[model samples]
Target: MRKIPVKYGIEILVICLTPFLFMISESISNGKVTGILFSFGYLILVGFVIFGIRYWIENEELVIQNLLFWKTRIRISEVSKIEKTWNALSSPAPSITGRVEIYYNKKSIVISPKNFEEFKNELLRINPNIIIKE
Candidate 1:
């Protein structure tokens, strides 16, 4: 198994969870909610910090797990292209910076791994036919 370190999208996480936070806080202040809202928010936000996120390659598949709630797997052989991107529209990538987009068989996914070169080189090592653009 090859474990690739993740680059956090803290700003993106904040942006995504801010609304829930505000709602929960307001509800608490107004005594409108019990521990249920707090528990739900804790599951979503604290779960990320506690359970953590990960990316790796195993059995010729790339695996991505985020916030303890999801997992995505992609076959390395199906990957066709890789390039750095900063596209802001929405992506699985945690950060807006140093994002790499992988275009596979009729599909694409974005990931931001901390060690960019290592991640790219590892994929290339497995599938040399993959085209990479700087």
Candidate 2:
């Protein structure tokens, strides 16, 4: 099984900083103890969610492990197209950069694996007929 790392760049930075910002704002308005607890809880939740998101290829399928519970599997034979995209629109992609859009089942999902080329090539290997749009 090949594990593909997610490219969490500036987007992750923003996400990591948001709770702290909120914590500071809350502390100024409310109280220190409450703000810290809330911020810690938020941080733990975000960390757990991010830690859970993973992508891998196994048994001729692309597996998307999400939020520690949700798993989205796409069969290799069903893949119709693969394309590189810079779209920041929210999707399965964890990052705002180096994303790939996979088309299948009359639908598509975006993902940002660290090795974008390798990920695309692996998918192409699985489905040689898949059209790759630059």
Residue lDDT tens for model 2, 71-114: 88999899998888987776667777788898999988888898
The Cα error of candidate 1 at residue 103, in Å, is 0.9
| Candidate 1 lDDT by residue in tens digits, 1-134 | 98998887678767657766777777777877665477476657654653366899999999988656688899999999999998775555777788989998898888888888999899999999999987
lDDT of each: 0.80, 0.83
Distance from true location, Cα of 32 in model 1, Å: 2.3
lDDT of 1 at 119: 93
Q: What is the TM-score of each candidate against the true structure?
A: 0.77, 0.88
Best by TM-score: 2
RMSD of 2: 1.9
Candidate 1 clashes between residue pairs 3 or more apart in a chain or in different chains:
9-94
Give the count of colliding residue pairs in each prediction: 1, 0
Highest lDDT: give the candidate number.
2
Candidate 1: residue 104 lDDT (0-100): 87
